[model samples]
Target chain A: MRNLKMTIQYDGGRYKGWQKQKEGESTIQWKIENVLKRMTGEEIQVIGCGRTDAGVHAENYIANFHTNSELSVETMMDYLYEFLPEDIVVKSIKDTTERFHARYNAKGKTYVYRINNGEVRNVFNRKYTYHTSVKLNLDAMREGAKYLVGTHDFQSFTSQKPKTKSTERHIKYININKTGDMIEIEVDGNGFLWNMVRIIVGTLLEVGMGHMKPSDVGRILEEKKRSESGPIAQAKGLCLKEVHY
Target chain B: MRNLKMTIQYDGGRYKGWQKQKEGESTIQWKIENVLKRMTGEEIQVIGCGRTDAGVHAENYIANFHTNSELSVETMMDYLYEFLPEDIVVKSIKDTTERFHARYNAKGKTYVYRINNGEVRNVFNRKYTYHTSVKLNLDAMREGAKYLVGTHDFQSFTSQKPKTKSTERHIKYININKTGDMIEIEVDGNGFLWNMVRIIVGTLLEVGMGHMKPSDVGRILEEKKRSESGPIAQAKGLCLKEVHY
Candidate 1:
């Protein structure tokens, strides 16, 4: 058996997400597995680096699977490219060590949230961004972001009921960039709980709108309560940018 | 009564073009007229500078209409912005002289066609660009464009069967720019016949692919027949960039 790793990019507008569900429901993993099973005549199970919610796009998602087929990586990639739908593309494929696992071996991840601050919505980019007519204070958002860029208990930033041994995670960096009427918030972290990124973005947006102060983020983190944070941002504006290993 | 000129932008993926057609079919002009009629309780007819084919987008389309509504220009613009569909946007509106007709008094127009030369199709921008795997010769295409940038009978470049006495037109400029995997062809002309811009783009594409030489454009123009030119490019790749008065 040989282990193969692949990088993927997908527009998740009409997909149920990156994980397989029921037989009839469509998902990114189910689509790939169905194609591979037909091509190789084997029940192949593919594992992704992480799970993404519905309507969340991905630019550089990673996955790996084991197969007994003798075909070259390039040939397999071509077959996958031809069989996959137009919304999902396999960027690259390569052979990997037999012991490598996609989910377990991941070291970190990065995500980006986009906000369209233009008064008039952009017809072309409406699907990829959250449109807001209200003007946002970038300085206030930057100040709020600074308080959350270290190891801390992020229970307040996630809706997931804490059942794990630790709810603490290290946020490596948070960068806010503005180009024209578009605002992008890029977050890099060691790991994240469910809905953590969306919650953090929502809280920061409140600060930008002057509803919350920069110092309020420190208190929200210390409180370790989900209700104390701002509402979760919409899923359509969140994208999984990269998975680091 | 006042004559109002409006600059509009739209994503034409779901529209039938820029003119009113049958009762059920949707068009840009029809959408605007419907809103105006409801707002003023008067029959509204919008005259566009030119008609765009089905699935052709517009970044800056010009149109004018006469109305007796007493509302200020800004208030009328706000009402249109609030009521128009998300795909169509009114960029700017202002009062213009009664003699300034949208179609009859136009000085010139500009159109842009986009081609994606990347190996992998961009999922995000698929609707806005036409994708091709073949490598294009930009220099050869530029050479061909030079022949078309002057006054000539463009009957061969248009699919329309002209009834007008003269088919001569002045092409001020044709700019071919290549950036990364994107090729943009921008054309400025005194006027254009039906399907003229698309056919011109198709002929230039053939020149880029080495099927037609740069020198063949002069002969094609002399022929003055539609069959002498290449096929018309797809409508989705063409956009009305601006109208110069």
Candidate 2:
């Protein structure tokens, strides 16, 4: 068997999510698999770095799979890109060991959430940005972001939905960059739970808008209860930047 | 009567163009008129700076209308923006003297055309940019652009379907900027005929692709025949930058 690693970038606007679902439901995995099947005439299973919710975008996502097709890596990548829809693009492909799992072997991940804090609607960025007509205090947001750095029990930030693994995860760094009418929050973490980044963004927005104090974030993190966290932000503003091994 | 001069921006992806047509066919003027009528419950007419073809975009188009409604500029703008869809935005509103006209009073107009000279399709910019997988020669394009900047008849560059009274238009300036896979051509002209910008772009592309020599543009311009021009570029790549008076 030949193991392959693929780096992907997708708009994710028309996709149900990254995983395959029941028949009649369109998904990113299903689209990729369908394209691969057309090219190789064989079933190919693709394992992505992680699952992104509907409407979420990705700049560079990693995936791995095993196949025995005779097509070279370059030929397979070019063929797949040509066959796939315009919304999804295969950036690069390479050979990898069979034991490297895109998810489990990932050493770090970076996610960036964009908030359009402007009075005018950015028509050019309407799909990729979440519009917040309400004005925000950028200084207060950066101060709140400082409290979110470092490893901690992030149960309050995660959703109450069940998962197969532990909820505790390590957040290595957090940076809040605010310029003009756009605010981008970059989070580097070992792993993120379901809705963790969205919840963190929601909490920071509350602080920025003066609805809650910066110290409120520490209290919520200590509560270890999902209800104590702020509201979840929209999925459209989130982008999976990179998954590193 | 109160004269109003307004700056407009639109996606232009949904309308039939700038002018009103049959009932089923939507146009930019029709949408603006409907918004104004809904706000004041009075029928009004709006005159635009220029007519853009269907699927073209604009950032700072100008328009004017007369209204007896006693609505403040801020209030009127708020109602229109709130009522209109997200794709259209009214940047600002001003009360102008009756002598001001959006079309005749305009001094110059600037247009920008975006060409995505890349192998991959950018999903976010799919609707706004023209994708070309073929490589272009920048030196040849620049040489051709140099020949296009001058006052001329422009009859050869225009189409027979415009049916305008005159085809004598002057091009004041032309600039080309290319960065990696994106090439933008900015044009400043006294006036433009129907599909004039699209035709210019098409002819320039032919020169850049080595299909025609740079000197061929001079001959094409002097020929004053529509058949002498290159194929018309698609409407998606053109954008009305601004109308200055």
Candidate 3:
């Protein structure tokens, strides 16, 4: 069997996320694996870099699989392009070392959340942006972002149960930039827990709108309680931007 | 009675077109008029500056309507915002001269067509762009575009029947610009016949792909036959960008 790595990009608006589920439930993994199985005549399990929540998009998702089929990478890519749905695309495929696991790779990930700070929605980009009418205090948001940019147990930022394995993760940076009424919050970390990025974005928005003080973010993280964080932001605005190996 | 003009923006991915049809047909005008009728308790008719083909988006579409309702502009805007589909938006509404007619008092319009000259589709923007795998010659397209800038009877560039009133229109400019994998064809004209912009884009694309020479464009215009032009381009890639008053 040869290990094959695939680079994927998808508009996850209509999908139920990346991981495959039981029969009848739609997912990005199921779609790709179904196509791969047909092409190779083998049951394939696509190992995704991570799971994306429903309605969340990804720009550079990586996955790997093992197959005994001796198909050329170009032929496999063309097959995927023809068989997969328009929203899901396999950008490239390559032979990889057997030990290269998509999930267990020692690396980091980057996520981006988009917010439209316009009084009215941007008609063209309405589907991908979280529309917020209230003016955000960027300076305050920046101050709050600094408190969370380091190795911390982001227990309060996730919906995952406390009994789960280690919640400590190294956050490399959280950059907030605004351009023409659109705000992008980029978060780079060793890893993220379930709903962690959404919850973090919600908390930062609360700080920008004066619902919470900048220092409150540090307090919430120390408390390690889900209730201490703000509401989970919408899934449609969050996108997995990059995976560093 | 008062005249009100609305600056509108819409992603026309789902609608039949801009014009209202007989009952049961989905249209942008029908949706807006339905909301206005409920808001005003009076029959309403919205006049658009021009018609856009189905699946053609618009960034700054202009429309005017007459209503006797005494409601404030802000209240009407809020009603429209709440009732209209998420894809369509009224960016602004204003009181205008009673003689203002959306179709008659218009001046000129600018449209843009986006072509993705990439081997793989852009997963995020696939819905808005036309994907072309063939390499386009920018210098050749620019040469062809030069022949189209100026007032002329564009009888050869439209799908409209020849018996139509007049095919003459003033094309102010045709700009072909390439940025990375995207090529934008921006056309500015005083008026356009049915399917004029699309057919023009199709012809220019043919020129860029070496199927036709740059000098062939002038001959095609002189021929004044619809069959003399290239195929009508897809509507999804076209967007009405501006309407100069």
lDDT of 2 by residue, A102-208 (tens): 98899989999998988777777888898887998778877877777888788889885635457777888888887889989899999898889999999999998
Off by over 4 Å in 2: A162-164, B161-164
lDDT of 1 at B141: 88
Q: How does candidate 3 fare on TM-score?
A: 0.98
What are the chain A TM-scores of the candidates, in order? 0.97, 0.95, 0.98
TM-score against native, each model: 0.95, 0.95, 0.98
- Whose TM-score is greatest here? 3
Interface RMSD of each: 1.1, 1.3, 1.0
* Cα lDDT, model 3, residue B79: 100
The most accurate candidate by lDDT is 3
lDDT of 2 at B86: 83
- In the range A1-245, model 1's lDDT, one tens digit per residue, is 98999899988989999997778788999999998898888989998998888888998999999999998877888898899998898888899999889899999999999999987788888888988879999999999999999999999998788766578999999999999999999999988888899999999999999999989999999999998999999888998898888
Ranking the candidates on TM-score from highest down gives 3, 2, 1
Mind listing the fnat for each candidate?
0.44, 0.41, 0.71
Clashing pairs in 3: none
State the lDDT of candidate 1 residue by residue for B16-121, as single tens digits: 9998678878999999999999988889899899899989999989999899988897888889999999889898889999888989988999999999998777
- Candidates 1 and 3 compared: the better one by TM-score is 3
